[model samples]
Target: MSYKRVIRFIVFIALCVQAKQMVAQNANTRPNIIYIMSDDHAYQAISAYGYGLNHTPNIDKLAEQGVLFNRAFVTNSICGPSRAVMLTGKHSHVNGFKDNHSTFDGSQQTVAKLLHNNGYTTAVIGKWHLISDPQGFDYWNVVPGQGEYYNPDFIENGVKKRVPGYITNITTDFAINWLDSRDKSKPFFLMYQQKAPHRNWMPEEKYYHLFDSTQFPVPANYFDDYQTRTKAAHEQAMEVARDMHDAYDLKLAFDLPKDQQKGLAGNWQGIYNRLTPEEKKKWEAAYGPSIEAFKKANLSGKELAIWKYQRYMRDYLRCVQSVDDNVGRLMEYLKANGLDKNTIIIYTSDQGFYLGEHGWFDKRFMYEESFRTPLIVKWPGVTNKKIASNSMVQNLDFAETILDMAGLPIPADMQGKSFVPVLKGKKKGDVHEALYYHFYENQEHKVAKHIGVRTDRYKLIYFYENNEWEMYDLKKDKSEMKNVYNDPSYSKVKSMMQKKLMELKKQYNDPVPVVTPQI
Candidate 1:
């Protein structure tokens, strides 16, 4: 054997070993991430939560295959602020977006920026409602704000493309396309946001006629007079019929007088022009059959409101249908590309929405309907598919969980504790004995500023704006119909929870309960 040849062969083997090590190192470096956010979606609306009014087979399947957290909540009940919280892992105040009207300070450390710094490709598609344009994402395409359902304009990689398609389906398309074209060498993180069931409730053509005749059962508190609840049923502005007449003008007939229905000062097109030609045709088809069916059915005024409830529920669910269809497609795409095992797919909304639970249509109240979001995660590590954890989770935990699961560093500013332990079906962080909720209400509906804490058995809400309080024993009265705030028996419970709320405020740096309204 030649000594020179032996040395050359040994060197070649060493070089190969180094190259293989580098490849393995890269594989062990980071994981691909996808996070989807939907607007005005509720835990009740999803079949995964098991209320069972609508069919969300895909989202439900995600839960069946992965971990479904029963008690996920948003920091703020609104869109922009909630998103900011999710990104920064900080509260609305810390994130510099107290409300939807405020701007997002992206300079603060974020999950996207952290992932980007950690050498993962990141992208956000659909519904970037932040006052400033997005940052840290390698690629971004988002709707302007409360984006149009038809002929929506999207700011793509750079250029703007106005496409005539529903926002839900189109947003998923953008996300899936980005995933398909992402750098194969590096793992990626994608935020797929959707603009559906937000406002004016526009559904796709195929879904327009969905459940046109079926009667959706009336909510338990459907005819609630707002007797006990000052704000719960007092929102005359957001009601289906009243807003249709006054604020929204949905009640105005095509030939109605200009001043009354059209509004003499403002643009009338806003009321009539929201619908595209295709959408108009579908609207007629959808309402036409239902209205005629009503005439023959001969429902009186009270029965008529019941009919209206059914119609409204149907439209909202149909909009959800489009969202569900795309989720199915995205899941299918993962299988086709063999990205299923490597990918972590999640389905959730910006906040839990009200779906006629308490005769309510919008989300803002600290009630369970509006506060708790339905979260389903399908990660590759979990062995059990249909596992349900009663452990309480909140929106704050999201940013921490994502970073923690990725084996990345979470910033000091993040207020949320990581639920990665809960996801793996292990209790690492404290399994929430009581969760705090504070919604400083300032919006179209005008709910009041309130703070509350939810223990496993008791729920306490203190109305700071009005100095009133409400408490419920969730175990006894899950519907929260009977408020035991004034009951003499619960005084001790109320004080105990109030003390807990103060502790939470100190912990989270939330405002101390001031008697006088700061505003």
Candidate 2:
């Protein structure tokens, strides 16, 4: 060959070899991310969080191999808004999904879309309450609305279909199936969410007998008189005694007349309608006797309230039991396939729930029970094993952290700071001086519209509709039973917190405003 031709050929071969090596290096460095989330999962329920309500061996295993964020929280402590904040790395107002009533604008930029655009494969499987078609995912199979615990319907790549079997197990099955079938050439991001342990808690047939023998003690404030608080405390309809339904929540007295079926029964009926004859047989075998015996008890007053608490705890824990079991199955799959070493696994919830705390069962208030959610992360090589961090991270920071872990540049428009450094134990102190929260949905649940800020020691809330303010010294009043906003000793503390709350509101570009009108 001529000298000139030989020189050109050599250069081309060198370029080809360099490109191949770069691709291999990228594949080796980029970790696969699997984010597992559940709806209304209270941090207190997790044994790892030390609340001691239930044992979640599989989730606890993640904490053993990684660090747990003890002070994790949500920007907006509700379902859709929380998820929206996580996706966009911004607060609800900025993301345009302010509450459950707001719809997510899919055309906007999201972490998933950003990752996909930057050469990663993305998928979201399980509960999606945003009420819009997923835009960024390469694959999506989500349960419609608040999905049924049994035989739920899922929208797979826009095709609606009901899959038989328990929803949690079924969702996990789809997740593992995706992992097995994904294009291994590129790193994958799978949002493996679950619809379990939400409202109308229904345990899998196998888990129906799980928590039956356990007698849960009622919370200390289960009979909270709302004496120290304002109208908001007394007005909410989420109290376990007043809100939990007969046929729906407790799965009792289904044989009673339709008129006698206290509260809403639609959720229960939906679960029942989906069960096959064989599944029904197994379910009845487990719960039938309990239902009959409860009717015979004719319990009342304090006895009835305590019974309801025990029943709620048992059912909630049973659902959690199934979740833990399915999580173990996912962990086993990852380990057996030798994919555990390079994967970053995360476990969190949409928001926290009330397990008879303050006699309440739902979330939305700025109380600690609904405000603080558990955040456990395990990144095989990156995370410090078994270490726990007290840094105040939020659902707002989740997107930025995921992007940073994946070695992508966080968008400037995103309002949250990446907590990857905190995860690695390189940083100290709270992520921010304070975390800001705004709850817009009001009047329906009797929860007044409010905005608040929580610091490491104290919390200050402004109930604008009622023109009331509440301040608490968290160290002393962990239950938040006392509102020290007007206390003489805390007057200075309240002023400082109030200023900080407004500063945060301005920093986030959500200035003080009038409360949203009641729906």
Candidate 3:
């Protein structure tokens, strides 16, 4: 060979080697992501949010070490649809999962798919309530639809098996096991989701009596009359006093008369039967006295309602305590394994729940309690420690933001914008001028179909089916007691918000027809 050709070949080989080294460096430097989400976990219940309803020290550690978002929300407030929005970075209408009844279209592009394609080993363990099997993950072990809190069944990579433990602990066990077994050379994206603090609030045996002695303060609007609001508010069947089942929700069926247990027998029995002999004994020992005392009190009128509220709060908070303890366990595991420094930890919920807000329990409303979700992110080096951001972000942004964090190109068709700039402290202001929300389900809870928009201070909601409108100056009416849509004093503000609402609907390509109520 010629000397000139030999020199050129040497240069080419050197360049190829340099390129391979750079690729390896980039792979190692990219942070591992652990996205932790809980079902029906209200922001008000978290100690970091300052409601002080319960103590969540472990979950609060995320806020202590990173950014706590004050105004994070969901596009849709229901379970399945909200998950779909987070996965696809699109609204329910575009994603084709508008309600609990609709199955998630797994073929569609998702952040998991994007990350998996771009060399991140992905796994999701815990509650996968989206009906269809999860796709685009190297590993997935999910419980079948609204998973049981005790001895839950997990479908691990298409194989179903009953796992013998509390759901929270079991889910964490699977996650930690996967982290141990994963390919350490590649960056990982693990969705360590939990089903604790969900409905039928069942805590692990250790936490069954956690809040039994504590007296939770009732919400100011616990007895909301819904007089000024539209028929939609009055029609909802989620009121704690009226609709919450005694046996199923409060766990009072065992000692109650058969007549009082008529409609609640099946639900309560199904949940109770899930416990083993030892677990059942422990559960009864913790709750048996309370049940007997409640019956003997012969509580009536408002007193009975108050008693029920306390019972509900105790059970619910116990479940939350379990979740917090498990969060601490997961965080310690990450730190012990040397993954903490290079991992991006995100904690959020499917959607917020009502803790007696406006006399309600289940979420489906575009109201503040259900519409807003908790978002706490701990990005090792980028996010500021012990800070709070009021930036208006939604679950719709999750996919795009995750892609951006992985240094991958976001798809042009995705509807949500990446908020990585905010996390990096580059963007100081809000990412969105206005946020849009639409709830399509008119089932279970009987909350009417509604669409709304919320800006910094004002909110405008329209119950299109009833041709009703409700406006709230959230700055003044944070509790949302008064409906001032027709108030003559704020006509100008109402008009402006209405116009913004239409712009958002158009921007989001929402197909729901607008029916402006005549004043």
Cα lDDT of model 3 by residue, 308-342, tens digit? 78888888888899899999999999999998988
Consecutive 10-residue window with the lowest summed lDDT within model 2: 510-519
| Positional deviation of residue 392's Cα in model 3 after best superposition, in angstroms | 0.9
Q: List residue ranges in candidate 3 displaced over 4 A.
A: 1-24, 255-264, 516-519
Kindly provide the TM-score of model 2 when superposed on the true structure, using C-alpha atoms: 0.95
Q: Evaluate model 2: give its lDDT.
A: 0.87
Root-mean-square deviation (CA) per prediction: 4.2, 3.0, 2.9
- Models 1 onward score TM values of 0.89, 0.95, 0.95
Off by over 4 Å in 2: 1-21, 255-263, 511-519
lDDT of 2 by residue, 54-100 (tens): 89999999999898989899988889999999999999989999878
Those runs of model 1 whose alpha carbons end farther than 4 Å from true positions after fitting are 1-29, 230-236, 244-268, 271-279, 291-301, 428-430, 516-519
